[model samples]
Target: MDTTLRHGPFVMQLGSMPVQNILVDKEWNIKQFIEVQSICSLPIELMLPPSWITGKDIDKLLSTEDDRLQICYRQFAHTLRHEEAKRPLLPNGRLHSDTLIDGLHSSKFWLLQALQSSGNPLHTFRRVKGYGDNYAGKGKPLAAAAFRPQIYDYLKYKIASYVDYRKDVQKLFNGEYGRVYDEEDLDYIRRRPIVPERK
Candidate 1:
């Protein structure tokens, strides 16, 4: 039997929900939600494993051209800095520990490496708990939640790209039939116009 799954923007071969829903909650605005979704649903072609033949593979990946992942790291760093700045003071109103800042920088480097080598953000970000926690209470420590100048901006930028990507993909597959008669016909079917005229 053939089945079709409908989402706000894109469809996949499988009937299960796309992973994006797990990342963004329903309360998020449509644009914010879809942007996260697009990043989550990026095609494999856009992701290529870097050659990890030497010292600190993660560092090498972040230094390379993949701007999308770079933005994510930048956001992560900004989040860390903001949180560190807000740490409970040592009576003199100064931060108690530099640990969080160090961790953020370190994690950013590793995350880039892991993503490049593994093509899995979860794997790359396993050490950092802020992205999302898989386990209920056994997750890694999260950076403190403090407002940073760049964190919101980077997040907004990434989310915007994600939204645009989702919109484009959804528009690309809006009104196609649920099932294809033949597997070989997919290319032709995808090329067919699926966008509906605005009413």
Candidate 2:
């Protein structure tokens, strides 16, 4: 009956002398319980940026190089974020699981799209090899052995300071944030094969 004591889907109680409100549900569950004795209240904490921002940055970086390169980088970044987000947030400050899962999904989608668009065996092979190396670290040596000569030739003539960007990127993430995948996490990601088609 009192305006100060509001009740609808939820209840809110306000006092005149003391500026404070108590919120509760019909079941008496404390949906929100706040005590304000003064004119000021606790400062609100800011939310962290969505993990996808990193992936988007990588995409922008690669977009200027080559279409294929752009696609590969975008997919990789997206996949990594998606996968990381999907995982349950660990107390150890690792990435969120759901992010990683979603990132991987985006990566796979883009990878397939790039392959289809390029229709170049070498590019496809290199991209796949990169993805494989990222997880298993098995195909890297072979990919390097095969592609190094061409990559070297490409870099030799150009003055675009050549370096293992993948390694650099990984290191950057690790140093700034933390390890994206530990031994156990890698094993889990590897074991969960991405089916070609959704069932």
Best candidate, lDDT-wise?
Answer: 1
Predicted candidate 1: what Cα RMSD to the true structure? 24.1
Relative to the true structure, how large is the alpha-carbon lDDT of every model?
0.41, 0.40
- Model 2: ten consecutive residues of lowest lDDT: 42-51
lDDT against true structure, model 1: 0.41
RMSD of 2: 27.2
Residue lDDT tens for model 2, 110-155: 3433333323333333343234333233433333433343554455
lDDT string for model 1 (32-114, tens) is 32233223442211222222312234433443444555455445545545765766322344332333234344453444334
TM-score, every prediction: 0.21, 0.16
lDDT of 1 at 106: 45
Tell me the deviation in Å of residue 26 in model 1: 6.0
